[model samples]
Target chain A: MSGFSRFTPLVNALPSTIPFVGPEAIERQRDVRVKARIGANESGFGPAPSVLEAIGRTAGETWMYNDPENFELREALALHHGVSRDNIAIGGGIDGLLGEIVRLVVEPGTPVVTSLGGYPTFNYHVNGHGGRLVTVPYVDDREDLEGLLEAARREDAPLVYFANPDNPMGSWWDAESIVAFARALPDRSLLILDEAYCETAPAGSTPSMDALIGQPNVLRMRTFSKAYGLAGARVGYAIGTIGNAQAFDKIRNHFGMARISTAAALAALRDQEYLRDVVGRIAAARERVAAIATENGLRPLPSATNFVAIDCGRDGTHARAIVDGLMEHGVFIRMPGAAPLNRCIRVSVGPEAEMDLFAQALPKVLSAVR
Target chain B: MSGFSRFTPLVNALPSTIPFVGPEAIERQRDVRVKARIGANESGFGPAPSVLEAIGRTAGETWMYNDPENFELREALALHHGVSRDNIAIGGGIDGLLGEIVRLVVEPGTPVVTSLGGYPTFNYHVNGHGGRLVTVPYVDDREDLEGLLEAARREDAPLVYFANPDNPMGSWWDAESIVAFARALPDRSLLILDEAYCETAPAGSTPSMDALIGQPNVLRMRTFSKAYGLAGARVGYAIGTIGNAQAFDKIRNHFGMARISTAAALAALRDQEYLRDVVGRIAAARERVAAIATENGLRPLPSATNFVAIDCGRDGTHARAIVDGLMEHGVFIRMPGAAPLNRCIRVSVGPEAEMDLFAQALPKVLSAVR
Candidate 1:
């Protein structure tokens, strides 16, 4: 267990805690293969066929480094969003970008704001940089925008994170409220507006790109990992002002991107028709999940995302048992980490076959847990 | 150009700079196709056919996120290196790992020691993390171990970087000197023994895995980018004590790895015979590159890497002219970023056709520069 003893005090004080235990880890630990992979909010329906073809065609070019500037990918992203490429910064995924964002703004003991039970990965990065966390609990299972703003101003915090169509709880705020919240934040506080689940959110739930493009304090994160079904591709981008985007260049691993993944993203963007078609499928699947939850005597939250949160009618332990019990049947799902939220179990949309597995297992798990 | 006005003072002071300009960018900027494609030190020979087959087959699974634990790949690498899986920490590439290492130990204004003409990307990471650099110049084209040690102790720098079979110069020190240098460092000073080229070095040039395993202050980095011919795959790992390796779990993008790339690394590791064969080709290409340099009346430095550095007879201007001149003929190559290292033009080992093009283009470019 000997480690370099001279690691910066911040690094030395941090514990090794992963944000999520991947389903694969569960398979290995429990010696059970997952049949319904729905826990991570990945698009179980997969990316378009054209993307797979692109990866196959580009496999031979795997020896050359990807363009560090990511010119083509950024241009495509910009074109899709009607913004300039200079306003885009690409990284391995939103997770990677979050780390960079945290590093750029957080000095030791700097107060950063986020909702309690928000993205653990962001909190991990903030803590890794020795930034003090000042969290506002979710209001009615939705991120408390007003509370977050109050905390940021009170603490004079330089960074705040807001996620629309939030994870775990599957709740969302209207676009106008979100825009108002962004405009009301102090210019001193940088806002990381994570729209990772926006593709699957209900209409009007996400602000238009133009609404926040001019705000230097706002960086909206988008990823191909969710509805695009390329979670394994590890492609994500942040849309911000040109100068804020360029800040990433100061410290990012210029050659860190995988060439084929870039190709996959390019292909994914080109196949927007497939994206539209899959978004429909995702909506249908979410309804199916909701229906299953309703039949199981659980209260399914109204969702603006690919996942639905089912109130398990008990404490955290009850939700935990149901999550573990479903996993025993190879039907994998997850629950929120912190209290009140943990009373619900989260289920992601998948194909009918996986949905059937979840349907069959949920009733049995509820019965067993009860 | 608007950016958040409240970024930490350290971030505001940093400039936007990339360590390396990729060849694709060169093609776009210079309005020319890279026919020879020997720039950036990427292997033009490409990955093995078997690895390509693996990527094609696994491309269908692009929907699932890579294992956050990287269990399978780490186990395979562990077996290959004859160490426990806990001894390895996976990263995007050596460049990515360097950034992480710098972040783990460096704070604002922290002093870091490295060779003056060493990898610009590593220095870029140190600066990105707000560390002040303390550079030791190369002696006889090799990184000065004594000077580095002296600087580290004098400045009480917590981090020092040394690359065996160094880049831009293709020079190396013997195993005995490397081991002695690692052991001589104060326990508080962490040595980054970058062995990115170890697979292609002379048999005794690299210390054995067990040589410095007991040193808590050392971490050796290896990559699949060079001899494994998977530069675009973005797979690299660090070898160190269990505790040191686990420390990465505290902050790394656990799910940032692309699934197909992990498959590519596993296949490449399992097919070491292919790697052995490719290393042979790389060595042959090095010799071919050296002969080409000699034919053009330049002195080719001895290389243990998949690239050769040819010292131009004049100054940095002469080297720059040759690099730019060769590009005019569709022969893409690069040179060191600073003098006296900038007096040399670097040519990465590639397929026979590319070498033929380099052989043809060099004399013409050299003559034109003259």
Candidate 2:
């Protein structure tokens, strides 16, 4: 049946495209099992066992809505970062928070600056809101800080998105460069510094929370979906000035956090020891993936995040063939959407068994695709 | 530190107000415990044991992102409702879905129609998107449907919201009138038929799925949060035409659903026997609440929902006093926000122990408030 005749023109103009195609969809479409499941940057090593216990214990309480204030989780995040709880705003994930941030700043024809192929979800949000995207392509697989700044100034764009320890390419800028970028943006422009993979980033790669804490124009995004290994839990938060965080209250699904997910996040936060250990495993898995890539004649890019982007030394179509070919062998991985970066395939870290499946499948796919 | 200086005029104009303050926030601010836990329309009786079991089973899989497509859940919902899978769109909850719907239809100063003091979350979403609300006050505690239709026509409103088994008052209209209302709306105006409480409503209170399925302008919302007893799970779906459902893909946080919540919802849907039992219990508890109100010399409104709204026989201030008084006794009942309707205190059905606590505390609190 046809839709309602009068959705706003902005909504009508948007393509019915999704940011990511999940492994479940892949499996259904291809009628093949995804044995490796090392895609989408999910932690196949899974959340800490303690988190599972918390979920089970809290399951019976699933009839209660989560606190709209998100007091406990925000408090825990505050104590962990040595900041005030008022600085944090919880959301479905960085993706959800990005939508709110876009809505808050972007009006129809407003320019929004970001790397050309950084995160499709962020782009999706900007497009959804009728913001004109001013793309700055990557410089050496790292987000082009200077180019983004130039576009913001040129368009007088009120919003700009920058992801440190970037997705797709799995590259990052040093702390100094990132802080400099935030400081460089015009005071009128809001900088959304997406730090979804920050917990896994090398020490010098992530800026200290205190470094940008008081910057009114900057909001740092973090997520449990990464190093915390709770992607399916859908818990992510934005850390910024209290006023910036409070702005989220003006337009958010206030009672939207899933109750058990909140409990799971609380338990996960309390278990810092687990997070530290998982980071070590992720680092090891990154190295393992790099080694596997190198052994199979692909060059794995240096990464500051949980995943590695392997250069296939060809164009988007060749990378697409490798992605499809690997999926045929029950290994699910993704590739960059645009040129240059699309010469690569991205694989997330997981348990050894899944990695082994990828290790076995990659060589065969490469050979067949050739 | 302050927020960014360049938010859109609309965002800058908005007050940072949450639609509903959580009971947890009340406990924190008032230094009281929620003994009865009967506010927020949440099922105090909790989710089915089988749903809890599903959560436990899915805990280990929380490392993976839920299928962005929400394919399985949509398929199950379609099978349950006798609609095609494309007819369903899943979200964090009905609250989240409302936000998306508002985003699609409302622009700055766009007139949207709804009952006065209806679901505040829906109104919250409308205002967030810069839509001007034209609220038609309830007539005799039920939504004035004819008034809403008139307002829709007069304002040429592109969007209107009405809930079946209405919140705050727990009042409802019969199915034929509702279907007629849907059919009579101008094609330019979209109808959001929020049926979040339908599971607890009487058989004829809701229009049959087939009755309005073909109407392009109508979208019916349902939740696992109510009689399915999974409020904290944050699972809700909108049923509409294929094109309408596809529109959600243009802008939704594609990977937003919590993996375990999806599992819990799937299990909840499969366990019809459990849902039937819970509906029976909810009805009995509704009766119990009415009896409690009668015994206290207050009037209880007729309800088609899990909660009963008791007329405290005074103004909003008196109702507020009763709510605050009951909280001092560890009872967490709530009242409507505006005038007239605010004369009532809303109490949700719960286990007998909680009802007994309410039964014990109400008289003393009412006396004190008086």
Give the DockQ-based CAPRI class for model 2: high
| CAPRI level of candidate 1 | high
Off by over 4 Å in 1: none
lDDT (Cα, 0-100) at A352 in candidate 2: 94
Runs in model 2 with CA error above 4 Å?
Answer: none
DockQ of 1: 0.87
C-alpha displacement of A154 in model 1, angstroms?
Answer: 1.8
Which digits, one per residue and each the tens of the lDDT, describe model 1 over residues B241-294? 998999888878999999999999999898888888988999999999998888
Per-residue lDDT of model 2, residues A1-370, tens digit only: 6998989988888887777888999899989998888878988888889998898788888889999999999999999998999999999888889988998898889999999888999988888888998999999988999999999899888999999989889999999999998998899889999999988888899899999999999999999998888999999999999999999999989888998889999999999999999999999999999999999998999998999999999999999999999999999999899888999999998889988999888889888989
Cα deviation at B49, candidate 2, in Å, is 1.0
